[model samples]
Target: MTSIGIYGSLGRMGQAIIEVAPSLGARVAGGADAQDDPAPIAAKADVLVDFSAASALDAHLAAARAAGTPIVIGTTGLSAKQHEAIDAAAQEIAVLQTGNTSVGVNLLARLVRDAAARLGGDWDVEIVEMHHHHKADAPSGTALMLGEAAASGMGTTLGEARVTDRAGLVGARAEGTIGMASLRGGSVVGDHTVIFAGQGERIELTHRADDRAIFARGAVRAALWLAGQKPGRYTMDSVLGDAVLGA
Candidate 1:
């Protein structure tokens, strides 16, 4: 059986992963929390999954790297420096990182990319997302991920096309720019919708996550796939494959 270690073992996502492990053909070898040392878990498990705070990322990545264990990072709100660290660690061990690790979400990203590419500049692209009230980070990581997909299809990066905040006198929406809006209320698991508005018609693609199990399953799937791969940086798209939409 595939043994996995979890960072942020006390958090909601971490607990969800542990709960869904058996059904996903994996077992929880152990876990590490803010108060605990992650080294033991890193040394014991076949692979590691991090759903912890961005502040703890450095130590977790270091532990995994030292042990030569593959790790899947599901934590959001990471800085560019942290991303660079992940990239550096990928040179020594397999590393998979994502904003939202839901098969459906990953599949949705594929669809958004294709739609943006075909719709051309005439069709304005917008992404809207909402999460639970307690969730932090505006626009959500998933929203940014989808924005990246849309931007990629538009032959640009999210950094160039992303429009997050809008105030009075913001002026007309820039052509070719991808807009993002965020909502937080109640106990919403997750909801993301991408709108493609054109002159004559509009197309909207959406995905709703009712439970955390979907993300847990995807993380497990990534961990399993990472185990056999050579040391490198990987994404859910590669793990699920370009043909995953049909699956």
Candidate 2:
């Protein structure tokens, strides 16, 4: 059986991964928390999964690199510098980092990309997301991921096309810019909806995650798939075949 290491052992997503690994034909070799050194677990396991805080990402990435073990990072709220670090690390060991790991969310990104590409620039793209009150990040990682998809569909980067805030005197929505809004409240697992507004008509696509298990299960599946792959940056689209996605 494949042995997977957990980087945020005490957190909900980590616990969920451990809870569901058995049914997926994998074993949790061990895990580490914020207060512990992750290298020990990294050295022992065949692959590692990180649902840890963004603050702990560098150390975790360093540990995995030293061990030459493939790692899947599910951490969110990362800075641009941290993203640069992931890009640098990908050259040495296989790295798969995603805002959200749920299959539904990833597939939603695909659909959003397709819709945005075909709908033309007249369609105003807006993404909205919500999560539990405990979530540290606004515009959950999943929200940014969707934004990236929409931007890509329109042949642009999110930085150039995103509108994250609006205040007094804000005029009409700019053409070709994608807007984002985030909500936080009681125990919501996750909810994301992408709106495509056009003249006299609108289309909205959405996905709701009711349990943490969906993310954990997808993470495990990604870990298993990354085990034997060559060093490079990978995505959920790599794990979920495009043929299946196209169907």
Candidate 3:
């Protein structure tokens, strides 16, 4: 069984992981919170799952690197600099980082990408996501991930194709661009929908997350898969495997 360590042990996701780990044939090596030192936990576990704040990402990555342990990061709201840090850490220790750990969400991303590729630039892409009111970020990380998938299919980058804010008098929707809208409300676990609009018709792909346990289940599965891998950066798609992608 994999020995799993958790960062942000007190958070909802962390608690969910702890609850589900044993059933998945894993043991909790330990955990660390904001006031706790993660190095010790990192050193002792076969793999580490991070659901902590973005500000603490550097320290957690450092700890994982120092201990030569694989890490699965499910933290959201990461800045470009933090992503750079993750990339750097990946050079040494195996790193699997994703905006959302739900297997359904990753599979949704793949489908979005495939649809974008097949539909071509003639289709306008827009992603709308809703999360719980307590969620702090706008255009939730998973929204951006879906946008990136559509952009990748269209052979453009999200930075170039993404249009997040559109208010009154924004003119017509730009061609070949991906739009993102975020909503916050009461106790919504998560909801994402990708819309593709063309001249005569429209296609929509959606995924709804009803509970946090799904994320925890996926994260543990990712940690188990990552534990045996060599040092490198990975994504949830890799965890789902190429067979699923082909399917």
Candidate 4:
């Protein structure tokens, strides 16, 4: 059985991962969060999974390094500098980072890419997402990622084509623009959809995250898959098979 470290052990997702430990063949060696140093607990762990705040990453990385533990980071909202830090640390240790952990979400992103690659630019692409009111980010990292997936497939960059949520009487939807919209309310975990609109018909692909456990399960699966990987930056796409994603 793999001994796991749950950074942000007190948070909703962390506790949820711990709750499903048995079925995944894992044991919580220890954990840490903003309120406490998971070091005391994480010391015994073999793989450290950081799901804590982006702010706490420095401490988490230091501790994981000292423990000689490979790390899997699930925290989103990281700046370019923060990503630099994570990438720098990966030179000395293994690190897996993802904007979202749901296998479905990653697969959805790949599907969006495939569709964009097959369809002409005339088929406008748009993304919509809904999450709990507590979420801080406007677009939700997953939404932006999906947009990036489509943009990448079309041989362009997202920054150039993105049409974020609109206000006022925003003119008409521009051709070739990848639009993004967001919704917040109640205790929603997450929901995402991508629409490909063409002159003749439209296609929609959606993923509804009814519970946070789905994410936790994906994280655990990623951790296990990373256990034997060569030290480097990794994503959920690498953990899951190509048969499911086709990319």
Worst 10 residues of 3 by lDDT: 238-247
Query: lDDT tens digits, residues 49-70, model 4?
Result: 8888888888887876676678
Q: Least accurate stretch of 10 residues (summed lDDT) in model 1?
A: 238-247
lDDT of each: 0.93, 0.94, 0.94, 0.85
Clashing pairs in 4: 30-41, 32-38
Model 1 clashing residue pairs (backbone): none
Off by over 4 Å in 2: 243-247
Give a tens-digit lDDT track for model 2, residues 131-222: 99999988899999999999999999999999988978899888889999999999999999999999999999999999999999999999
Candidate 4: where are CA atoms >4 Å away? 243-247
Give TM per candidate: 0.97, 0.97, 0.97, 0.92
Global Cα RMSD, each model: 1.1, 1.3, 1.5, 2.2
Better candidate by lDDT, 1 or 4: 1
Which tens-of-lDDT digit does each residue in 159-245 have in candidate 1? Answer: 999998897789999999999999999999999999999998999999999999889888988998888889999999879996677
Pairs that clash in candidate 2? none
Better of 2 and 4 by lDDT: 2
TM-score of 2: 0.97
